[model samples]
Target: MNLFDLGWDDFASKSFHPFCSGDLVPARVALGHKHACELLSAHGELLAECTGRLLHETASHADLPAVGDWVAVRLRPDEPRAGPASRRRADIHAVLPRKTKFSRRAAGDDGGEQLLAANVDTVFLVTALDANYNLRRIERYLAVAWESGAQPVVVLNKSDLHPDPAAIRAAVESVAIGAPVVALSAAHDESVAALAPWLRPASTIALLGSSGVGKSTLVNRLLGEPRQPTGAVSDAVGKGRHTTTRRELLVTPSGALVIDTPGLRELQFWDVANDSLDSTFADIAALAARCRFGDCAHRSEPGCAVQAALEDGSLDADRWQSYQKLQREQAYAARKADPRLAREHGTAWRKIHRAQRMQQRLKSGE
Candidate 1:
């Protein structure tokens, strides 16, 4: 595989110079496993594991190589090939700086960021048009996608099931801000042509969505073969069982690199900054600009544009609530990431609690 086909460019070449002089070769991580990874190098596909020094020096798991990451690898010439079943193995010495990355909070209470895919040019936020259609979920995805620095395209899959796919696409477009919404049945070849613009040659796109949203099916369709296993959605719950168990990058027949991820059951934002949040909710941000106060919270304040829109029905109540919920969550995650901010927040809350208790005692004549 050509390195450029995997999204490599001058930025990657510049970042790779530090390790280029040695036996190190630039490879893109095609599949990331717990202990090892499959990389696409100039020499072709090879299995590689991170060097002990690389693992020990890393501050967090997010620093490790992920699917779609470009890394400096050293091929082990002395080690004999394991067997016909496995490719030659190498050691990944370093990961180049990612121009874009999709990430979410790690599952459990760790409060750590989990890198999903790196160096992706576009993200396909797939959602089925059936019972799984959810604007709120799409909004959440848009937040992370915006934070990732990648262009987000909403793919309304299973369009054949809907009588008016255009209507559904319009609805998605309303809340999607300026992001493009493409409605197509991945099962149909003609309909899938709508996605060709984003699947440009040499660009990397990642498919992301919940279970039963047909991400794997879309990958298969794009590949023009059943390379990825797909599952059927349950009639009762409209949810499909997990089929793609791991994140893997593949080259589509169209000459574009694509990453197919396992359907995400939970997607929590991790370290998303306020600028990205505003970009995701650009509609609200625009309305907020008309408010009388620059610092207006848009709640019960006089001349508050957001609240006025909510009252007059110009803005959606559900979307406003979703925005608020995400804002609070992002704020909390930020506080968690910064110990000083968390301490200040706790102190402020304690002061408010004390003031409330004092007022209560005075009212009761205690």
Candidate 2:
């Protein structure tokens, strides 16, 4: 098979370096486990491990290859590394610079973001139209997708379970703003073709959603086989078991590479910048541009375009509020990174509140 047929273009674009040209063999990490990885090279599939030196010098989690990382590997002659003692163990010499990385804050207090996949061209934010459909949650996923630097496509899976798929699509489009939202049932073979545009060759797409949302089912449908198992949904909760335990890189017959990740129960925000947040909330940003003041906070600020739009029915209050909530979350997350800045912002807030109280007293003639 040609290199391009196995999703090589996307991975190579990120990790290939001129300096490493000729000396190293290129391989894409198909699956990453704690001990080793499954790598797909031009020659064939191989079981690989990082050199002890590479492991010793590793500074962060990102240093270790993740699913979809294009790595520079020190080739071992036909035989697999004999054992732990062998010096010829496949070593990850280096990782090519990534074109795009999809990440979310790791769950819990670590405060570190977990890299979900690297060099992804498209992110499929899957949401189901059954009892689990929640537009607000879709908005949250869009924020993370936009932040990942990949084009986001909202996939409304399990549409057959819902009588009004259009309503669910409209709800997703409401917050999606500029994203493409498609409704289909991954359980049904024909319905899965709706994702054809993104399933083209050389493209790398990752499926992300909460567990039991049919992420695996969708993956199996696209594969045209039961490569991934579908879990049975509970009769009471309408949620299925989390069938996918690890992230895997699967090559489709169409030559597209798809990464199926275990569903994310929580997506914490580590340090998403305002640009992504702005992109996710573009509608509010566009409305805010016409605010009377250059720095209108949109909270009772005279002629505040966002507030005006909300009152005049040009914008949805729920969406506007969601934008503000996400904005505050991003701002707080940023502040958490810098102690001095956090302190400064805390003091500023107090002073601003104090000044506002005084102004209110004067306006009330107290």
Candidate 3:
């Protein structure tokens, strides 16, 4: 098996220059389970583990090898080194720069974001066309996808189960803002060809959605076999139970590489670019440009173009509110790292609010 067909050129061109010059083996991590990894190297597929030195020196989660990280490994097949009897461990000397990384803030009180998948060229935001269909959730996923550097292609899976998949697609497309949306049934294998453009050889795509959305079934379809197990959806809730428990990269028969991750119940905000909010809420952002004041909050502010549009039926009120909520969340996430600065900004806002309240009280003589 030629590892070069698995997008090795990307790693070779970017990582090979500065680090190892002679007899260094470059490999891509196919799967990561705890401390063990399955690496596709120039030699062959090997059950690999990180070196003790690498593990001892690593302090952060990002330092570990992820599913898509390209690493330079020192191969020792038939020889044992002096330290602790070297047992074919791969020393991940360096990580290649990622083209695009999909990440999310980890659940709970920890403020740090976790990198889910790196170097993904495209993101398949899968959603079931059945009762699980939710345009609002799709919209949120779109924001997260835009925040990542990858292009998002919305996939409305389980179309065969729905009587009218067109309705769901239309509703999702209404807010897709020109993003490509495809309706297909992963079980029946129909219209799966529509995703071929993104499944080109060496291209890496990831499927992200809630449980029972047929992501695993879709993975089986793409692989042309039942590589990932499938589970039946609950009869009561019509939702499939969580089947895929880990993020593993699989190579399809078409030679395209794909990473299938476990279902995500909560999609949180992370390090979003400044333009991501504008791109996700283009309608609101564009109208804000025409506002009378340069900094219209769109809240009860006079001459608020966004509020005017919402009131006059030019823009959907619900959609506008959703846009505002996401914008506020993005703003909060941006300031989350600097707690001190956030507190200072909060104090300034509170002072402004108090001043406004005092002015209103004086005007009414209350």
Candidate 4:
């Protein structure tokens, strides 16, 4: 396979320049296993393992080769391997810097991030029009998508199952905000073509959503084959059965790259971007900016535009709640990840509350 077809470009070339002079070659991770990963490079497909130095220097599992990651590997071509198929092997020496990464807090309370996909150009936040669809869940996914530094496209799959997909699409549009909303049944080839605009040559797109959201079906549609397994939705559970067991990247005949990952059970905030709130909830941010108090909590602050919007019909009550929930989650995650910052936040909140109490006492002529 061509390196360009694996999403390699000038930026990647520059990143691997130091390793270029050595026996090392650049490769893109196709499928990652426990201790090894399938890589695509100028030498074609090969299975590779991280070298001792690479492993010893790695601080976190997220630093390891993940699907859609580019790495510098040293190939042992012409060397005999003790394998049934005599497949070639390589040693991954280094990983290239990721331009964008989709991450979430680990499943447990480790206070660490788990990388879902890396170096992606676009992220398709897939959601079903079935019972699995939830506006708040879409809002949650949008938080991480905005922080990933990639363009988010809300793909409302399984439109055929909905009573009125157009109405549902409008509802999703309200929460998706800056992201483009595209509703289509991935079961059809022509219907999935609506995503063609983002499937440019040498660009990587990741499919992410809860189970049964048709991410594998979307990949198969784009691949023009049934490479990724698909499972029917269990009527009893109202969720799609587990079909994709692992994450894998495949290049289309048109040179576009697509990655399909298993359904995420828990989507938590990782690194809250400085502008994600402003970008995802522009309406609320704008209203807050117009508040009379610079630190308006939007709760009981006088001249608070947010509360005023909620008083009128301008703002959706549920959306404001979702924004607050996400903000709290991000703030908590930040504090948990850093103890010093946690103490500082505690102090800050105390000061704010004290100030509010003092103002109330003065108003009461205490």
Point to the candidate with the largest lDDT: 1
Using lDDT as the yardstick, the better of models 1 and 4 is 1
C-alpha TM-scores of all predictions: 0.92, 0.85, 0.83, 0.88
Q: Model 1, residue 238: displacement in angstroms?
A: 17
Give the residue spans of candidate 3 off by over 4 A. Answer: 10-12, 56-59, 79-89, 232-247, 337-366
Residue 122 lDDT in candidate 3: 90
**Candidate 1, lDDT over the whole model:** 0.87
Q: 153-252, model 1: which lDDT tens digit per residue?
A: 9999999998998998898999998699999888887888889998888899999999778888899889998877677432222243332234379998
Clashes (backbone N, CA, C under 3 Å), per candidate, total: 0, 2, 0, 0
| Cα displacement (Å) at residue 79, model 4 | 2.5
Q: Per-model C-alpha lDDT, please? A: 0.87, 0.78, 0.77, 0.85
Cα lDDT of candidate 2 equals 0.78
Which of the numbered candidates is closest to the native, going by highest TM-score? Answer: 1
Query: Positional deviation of 11 in candidate 2, in angstroms?
Result: 7.8
Which structure is stronger by lDDT: 3 or 4?
4
Please give, for residues 1-366, the per-residue lDDT of candidate 4 as tens digits.
788778888878888888878788899988865488888888877889999998899988888888888999988767765766755799999989888888888877665877888889999999998987899998888878888888999999999898899999998898788899999999877899899999999899999999778988899899898877776532222353432234388887777899987777779887786488668888888889999999998999899999999999699999999898889888888787677998998999999999999999999999
Report the lDDT tens digits of candidate 3 across residue range 1-366: 576776777445666667667666778777764467777766666557777777887665665777777777777655555555333556565666666777777788765667677777799999998877887788788898888878999999988888888887887787888479999988887679989989989888888888789888899899998877666432222243432233378889898889887677778787676687777777777899989899877788888898899889988877887877787777777767457868998999999999999999999999
Q: Give the poorly placed runs of model 2, Cα more than 4 Å off.
A: 10-14, 18-22, 80-89, 232-247, 336-366
